[model samples]
Target chain A: MDRSNAMPTVLHAPISPADIAPFKIGDVVYISGVLYTARDKAHDRMLADPHLPFSLQDACIYHSGPLIVKEGDTYRVVSAGPTTSARMNAQTPSIVKQGVTAIIGKGGMSQEVARSFAGRCMYLAFTGGCGMLAREKIVEVLDVYYAELGATEAVWKLKVLNFGPLLVAIDSRGDSIYETVRARSHERLLRLIAERKRAL
Target chain B: MPSHREAFILHVAQALQEAETRLPRDVTRALANAAKVESNDRAKEQICTILENVKLAGAAGLPMCQDTGVPIFFVEIGREANIDFGLKEALATAVQRATDAVPLRKHAVYPLTRRSCDEPLFDMICDVSEGNRLSVAVLVKGAGSENVSALAMLEPLQDVRPFVLNTIWESGGKPCPPIIVGLGIGSTFDGCARLAKRTLLRSLEEDQSPFEAEILEQINELGIGPMGLGGDTTALRVFVEEAPCHTAMLPVAVAVQCWADRKARFSIKL
Candidate 1:
């Protein structure tokens, strides 16, 4: 809950562990630099392949399935928004183990995934459905990998500029905003249900 | 000039683009109000970004969100229109054209094989109306909210409140709250699910009944807030559409819609 700094932290990708160390849950961040898009299928493929075409060292993984179209010679990103991240929960820790230091997505991730960030990772929450905003930040579509996975599921290498207003929802210490919200909300739900039972 | 059937197909494509790019007026107003009331900095920021995204999408004529979603069409055909064309086939063609024209994400895939489908992704529900006007509306539904939607066949005495609350709780930020909840009560299993999904098309500008308001209040009370980071605006509205069912059955379905609330409509007088 330390949102003391009014300014958003500017992060450059290939984000290092040290770069993410100062930020905590509830802080805001903006990313500028290289990131890769990896959804459910891409995650499976990335982990299964022994030799990935791209390196994962200090890489920033974006849980997105961008709407990209080919324009004769090159690809154009139409609308690139974060997909639900919880679905990637299982594959995430393994990806983190491969030296991923930053993950940008919506809907947050699992507690297990939070625990996976214990020492060298952070999860940034982008507003869901903000595809146009995301598109604005993406300066270039560097390349595409795994085109066979379909445009939505393929791994896209992108270069972005100040790509955020992302909330630091999970810190390296394993504290998570989603976990805290869920706990508080559960208590309220129980109270409301109890009142309902009594009324009945 | 294109044939009447061709014209109708083009209309559907235009409707798809309208639905994908612009947040409906009712939805935009609701989100604006929600933004004003949001006390938490995180929640406020999320709402503001959504508003900004909507503006940008509309201005640039881009799909508001990347997940343009499976296009669900609600077609109201006038009986006197004497429809000569294959409505379903025409709708399919429109979707295919829009896939490239509006640049919708090719979201449909084969269920088992998980490969891309040649046909554009869409669902259609048709209704017969009195006049000679064919009205078509589209709701672009994203997976995040649609996945969390639940249907429960509760006992006759079972209350609907708990099921609704529990669904929202389990959903957490996954559906991208502040969500719009559509509740279908007292119909057959599949019918109730349809009832719930259809309710999502209703404009938020419409008034809510006390029951709908109460459920809405209770849901927001869960404090799941925007993106479930926690706050007062878990859901902007709750719409309930109920149908009488057998005495032994109390089927309820919850259809969750994300904040985008993207929808558009077009009417043709034949």
Candidate 2:
């Protein structure tokens, strides 16, 4: 836990199984290189469409709805930050199976999602709602897919640099920080209610 | 003529951008206080990150959150307002202008078809007021919190506190704590939702009712902390708005709001 000695890991895409293996639950990471943006709608589309324009192998997917502007013919990222990943739970396990090595989002996923890690995938959460911070880390947006799915839910191929302080909420071995906190909080909630008796 | 339409459009656009990028004074103060009180290291770290993010977003002139949320307008129109132009059209135009100006994510989708809306997009709620002045408040609420907001019709004798607690517990980290829980007790089921949603517009500096204060204390004690990581700041504030209900029903609505809590308001005289 010594901050001065332990430098954070900086990951670049296409991230390999080996590149992410050293990360565990609670290790903070910074990601650079090629990352993809896909939320609920894009997830569904990618799962259904066999002819996905981009490959999913070793891909790092970010759940984001970037505020982007079109300047002449190019797109500029104005704000890029993570969205809640819990909503994508149903599709996440399958997406991981498709060889996604890392998933970046805010809020953690479920037990089922943790199970999908299978010692080969990890879930990284950035500062929720910190779009400006995230956007600054994004160096360029390479290409966009499914542009029709509205801005938030579309697929964005982005080139990033040091895209973190990403806390590893779920690690490759199927361990989850969320579940740990949930159990602890639930116990506290009960004790607090019992002490107060909800009398007021 | 003060060019009401044009001025109002500009006002709305500015408000939208401000709401998207900035946390209101009361919200920031609440967060600062929360950080001071949080004992859990992880929870404190999360709160600090949020505060730091706010500063970074402001410096960069970018949205504080990537979701940018669904832009919702609460419009209060005066009784003697002379409306030579269409208010709805003007508001819509304002939304488009803000969309391009703020560069808000075009996330609107047709409910049934899931197809996207092409132009400046946002939702609005209109209410009539007594004066000749027009006031509009804009709130940028992200889906993370919206997805957890719920309405329930409980038995007349059932206590509302249990249901509210359960909602927060079940939501866990999904709504992006530390969040504000806006409770609407009494009124019809749908009306309760409206009440709860409206309560979010109130400033955190407003006087807290006794019930609200008690709930706030207990919610923090739940130790959901910031981002549900376990701490004493699970919720920064609890706001309750109530209305009369029928003789045999107890309706409750919980509107979960994320820490972003971005809001901006404008009042203009016609």
Candidate 3:
């Protein structure tokens, strides 16, 4: 509950595993520099393909499918926001093994995926559905990969500038805020059910 | 007179674009109010970012969310309208045009195979009414919130409250927090889901009944908070829509809407 310095700590991509390693569940941080986008299809491809289109060593992968329109051979991002990460739970552990230091998305991942972050990576919870906010942080779309998957699932390599007010939902130590919150909520739910039973 | 067919198509596309880029007033007001009262620092921060996102989208004239959701249209057609356009075909074409006009995300997929396509996607519920005008309201339902929606057939005399609460609780942060709950009670299973889905299009400014108020209070007490990060505003509101059911059945459907509950409406005089 330390509210000191409400502003998030600024981070740049291509960060060392140890750089994001210090962040705990609930630490507020911002990211700038290079990141790559990958959604469900991209996840499947990244795991099955022998060669990845781009390197992921100590890279940051954002769970996003941005809305981009081409302008004279360049892609101008109209809206770029994180998609739900839970859908990628099955593939995330393997993706992290590719040397991804941090993962950014909304609606935090499952326990199985969090376990994969044990001393290797962290998960950043971007504000869900905030394409406008995310777009401001993203300065440019440098390149895109896997266009065959359609626009929403393509992996867009992006150059960002101070790109986040990312909430650390999962720490490198394997703690997930989603789990903690669900547990607390479940306890209250039981109490609620008991109250209903008594009333009946 | 202009081409009613072309005009109608433009009308639907405009509604889709409006739904994409703008936050309807009621939804925006609720988010602002939720942000002001949220107690947890983390939850407050989430609200701040959401509020900032709203402003950013307005300034940029782009979609407030990249998901852009599946465009769902509620079409009310006038019975007396002198119309030659095939209503269904016109709507489908409008949706496809808007998919690019609004630059909506290419998200249509083959449900069975999960194969993605550039198809113009939309679902419509049509009703014939007594006027010479067609009214369409589009709701942009992003998948994050759409995936958590639920329907249940409770035993007769059983309470629907617990079912609704449980659905929201189980969803946790998956649907995004500070969500809107639309409850469709007492209909057939699929019918209940439709009832619940339609209620989400209603304005939050409308007066809430006692039951609606009660459910809203109980849900916020779950302490799921904003973004499920922990705080006062797990759900901004709960809307209940009910219909007559058979004596043996008590059906309930929960349609969840995220904080980015984007919707818009347009009426054309044909």
* Candidate maximizing lDDT: 1
Q: Per-residue alpha-carbon lDDT of model 2 for A74-169, expressed as tens digits?
A: 999888878888889999999999999999988889999999888779999886788888887889889999987866778999999988888888
How much is A97 displaced in model 1, in angstroms? 0.5
What lDDT does each candidate get? 0.92, 0.85, 0.88
Model 3, residue pairs in steric clash: none
Kindly report the docking quality category of candidate 2: medium
What TM-score describes the B chain of model 1?
0.97
What class would a CAPRI assessor give candidate 1's docking?
Answer: high
The digit string of per-residue lDDT tens for model 1 on A112-173 reads 99999878999999999999999999999999999999999999999999998889999999
Best DockQ goes to which candidate?
1
In terms of TM-score, the best-performing candidate is 1
Off by over 4 Å in 2: A1-4, A190-200, B1-3
Model 1 residue B89 distance off true place after TM-score fit, in angstroms: 1.0
List, residue by residue over B1-270, the lDDT tens digit for candidate 1.
335799899999999988999889999999999989888877888898999999999999999899989889999999998677899999999999988897989878999999988787789998998999999989889999999999999999998899999999999999989899999998799999989989999989799999999999999999999998899999999999999999999999999999988888999988
Winner by lDDT between candidate 3 and candidate 1: 1
Clashing pairs in 1: none
Residue B136 in candidate 2, Cα distance off native in Å: 1.4
lDDT order of candidates, top first:
1, 3, 2
